[model samples]
Target: MSATMEPRIQYAKTSDGVSIAYATLGEGRPIVFSPRVFGDIHLYTNVDYRPPYIGPLVERGWRVIFYDGRGTGSSQRDATGGDLNRRILDLEAVVEAVGSDRFALCGVASGGPAAIVYSVQRPERVSHLVLVNTFAHGAEYFESIPSVRVSRDLRHIAEDQWEFYTLALANALNAFSDTETARRLAATIRAGVSPRAWIAQRDALEQIDVVDTLRSIAVPTLVVHDRADTIGDFSMLASKLASRIPSARFVATDDFARAADEFMREGEAPPTKEEQLPSGTAIILFADIADSTALTEHLGDAAFRTKARELDSALRAAIREDAGTAIEGKLLGDGVLAVFASARQAIEAALSCGRAGDEAGLPLPARCWCGRPCGRWRALRQACGLRTVAIRR
Candidate 1:
């Protein structure tokens, strides 16, 4: 539950006059994190999310930078523009502000497209490129994800039930197992944007197609995806994207954090024990009682045991049906731990488990110290299930 300390927030001015908030942290060669809509600088600087991706680099003397693109986080909120070229203005502002003549570029999820375009335009400055759980073309995402159409997607949900949307996204990303982390992500997202602004901004960013730009990249590139990702055929598409790049060679590894490290360390010697390859991550789920003793005293041991067993059985059935691995152990008699492959599967199965507990008349509850852990698990799950791609040289 611990995380990297939050640095002082600094501002960068985009050509559009949007003031981007960013932080200059760590040491060594520089690496810039492209912006994400769901998270701001506050979320990334937390324990769960940014550390696994940036921590090892920091220790190895890499100066990693993080920033808010515009609509989300600490940046200008009222102007939630969806134009891709305009978004890159935010990136340009950050790079100029830091004055790092050369640096590596890493992009994850929705953040990748801008980073790709940026590298293409500034080939001389961007030394290496890393893309994780992202796609080359925006349309591929819409076509691949189940039941997600251009007319109906996150924007619609953001309008009707913004809080619910945030929680659901957290569960999908977190693997539906970590209740606490999901709650925290939900809170962070709720704070990041309003329903109106989210819809307004997502109009353009819903899908960031850059198929034509892939081959234009001159830097060494790493494109990573999880083979097990059940978010449609996004992994396959990612591999195809990597193949388009002349300088890119594909790889499959659970420890791509190491792949990223080694790729970024292109000019350096062999890797040491100090840094670790990023591993394929997954989310875990559990059902726990807030006060087992109190409930037991009220229900009587025999009746409580019978109901608990029934609830567990129902939960396990849902897990099996959804193709998730239910871990058997004593997380406590009333609790169960399960692993899921996809965000959609995890969310659906967890909801079913919650229903089982309710139907069995058991009051189960647990709170978490939410920060970055929730989404990290989900991102890991997504990456592990999708295929992985790294630099050729």
Candidate 2:
């Protein structure tokens, strides 16, 4: 499938009469994507610059669903007082609108709690649940992660310095320092909602506490996390989240794309032992801090070491958050290496590293550079020729 193929946008009305915006892409088993806070379906589905993560799934022949939450994106902005119930109602509205009796739900970031609530409430409708870089309790996230608490000051930034906040947020979410991507994301954020709605959504996100409700989920669930994520430690957050649900499977990867693909492909019979390995095209992404020698000289040994650890944590976190797998590569002092399922995923993950580093207020802010190399994997044969191109910002 070509990356330029556009998805048709449509609307679904909630029980309260608020219109929710949505779009359908590709073909096959329907998978409804629960939007991150402030997500806009149109921005996400734009053929010119759609998120790299969604493309692979669509190309693999899945009918992917995208939607804007109430008060954000192309959805009804007048519904500014949306709460948890209203959020659930929005999902319900979208599901009903899509007319899918049984489908999969993939929750990204803040969308996780809402997906969890809906899965439990409508178990019969949800065939599978996938949560990525998400937390069970909103309060726990703010209280446990100091950086998250500091980032909450983003509300003030969003309200007072709207443009700066969006750039910062885009950088933080993407975890890289690509100005072009940041600017694009900034426009998307601005087009998605007003400052007031952004604050309202953040307020609603903070109130989410679905820990007590996890056990009630009856659908097959997959919880994925990257241990190096800067938002929250996987051991501290996502692991506990997976543990709460009965029979939930926990898979850890450096990136979210491959794990997500695995989750979406669930219920299909596994390949035989002889056919277990994968072949064909794979994209490898590598990221590392730039100007480490100068940075170390400026910050000194002790401080530089601390900063390196922080950068490592932030980059790893960003990779996982972006759904790319982190490959253990030779440490080049101030840089790290990871592998991604697609060039887009790798690029996005690298960009997110810069954004995450900025949001964490690291002493030595990191800028990530990515390279894409294509290669084929033969089950038991050595690899052949490979070509790589570097993308730096």
Candidate 3:
């Protein structure tokens, strides 16, 4: 027999004639995780599970229960018909079938809606509610603004360009697995479900809306939103829900996807640049594109001009907010600067700017530098200690 250590997989039949697939691991209070079937949970375990909020929860005696929604994973393929009501019941059935009553629920993305609905229908079965990067209403989720809508037309990619779709899914999950691991998971997802099944799920998710029912959720709720999340603006959506729900708490985290992508390659060498200072100190940080001219070309003159102005304003605000004084300089066609503060603060500011650009839907360029401020920085070398570099606007 071929050796296997995969998370134990099992299936349960739902009332609506659908077989649900789930995997259970670790030990403690049952914390049921109803994840959006972007792919198999096993595939994203290493990549997606590495988040600080999750890994710790599991380690601290929480039996995390993860399952595939309808039309996903090892679940029955014929059970996928694009219905939110059915999906909600599927979630309830999974929890009940698994023998975990009064369990904690953590839902992400589309799963958030599912969890909310399930919680409403079976309020007595839930303990604590943790919603991360999720939305209450489908329309409001995608339509962050009144006029704008997030793209859901994956048919072209799902049909002819299948691999790209898998890769994109992997990318969204920040697939940190090695080439072999990624390939195996991607193949498994593609093999497990038909394109029609995915289509049904996608369409069902788009048609979902439950903004009105959010107030009825009486469970203790924790909402975590990524400042740089491209999916939906949970900041506004969470605020709306939190206001209605009396005991809800809202917390903001850095971009989980980006952070996942950055830390994925476990044994791989981290990108770092180090230099030595005259005082025998060293500085290290990763640096690359602050402003790529191609982004300007792509954004067009009008949008790019407006984006530049916004970028300038954000930068100025950051500077004014005790991040660090911008020791203004120019790098290529973009502006450059130096900071005399702690290395961590500079790195944080850079990441913050990147997040802001992404939120504004503007393609901002970026470069990071960290290490010993040695001969590489003439001003640091000349000053022998912290020294201000030339300022330019």
Candidate with maximal lDDT? 2
TM-score of each: 0.64, 0.65, 0.55
Question: Candidate 2's residue-wise lDDT over 113-200, tens digit each?
Answer: 8899999988999989998778888888776665455447677777889889888777664444346755887788787788888788
Worst ten in a row by lDDT for model 1:
384-393
Name the 10 consecutive residues with the lowest summed lDDT in model 2. Answer: 378-387
Query: Which numbered prediction scores highest in TM-score against the true structure?
Result: 2
CA lDDT scores, all candidates in order? 0.65, 0.67, 0.56
Could you arrange the candidates by lDDT from highest to lowest? 2, 1, 3
- 91-154 per-residue lDDT for model 1 (tens digits): 8999999999999998866678888999999999998899876767767755665433422355
Per-residue lDDT of candidate 3, residues 6-31 (tens digit):
46778877887788887776677787
Stretches of model 3 off by over 4 angstroms after superposition: 1-5, 39-42, 45-54, 145-151, 154-157, 164-192, 227-233, 254-393
Scored by lDDT, model 3 comes in at: 0.56
Off by over 4 Å in 1: 48-51, 145-154, 226-234, 271-393
Poorest 10 consecutive residues by lDDT, candidate 3: 273-282
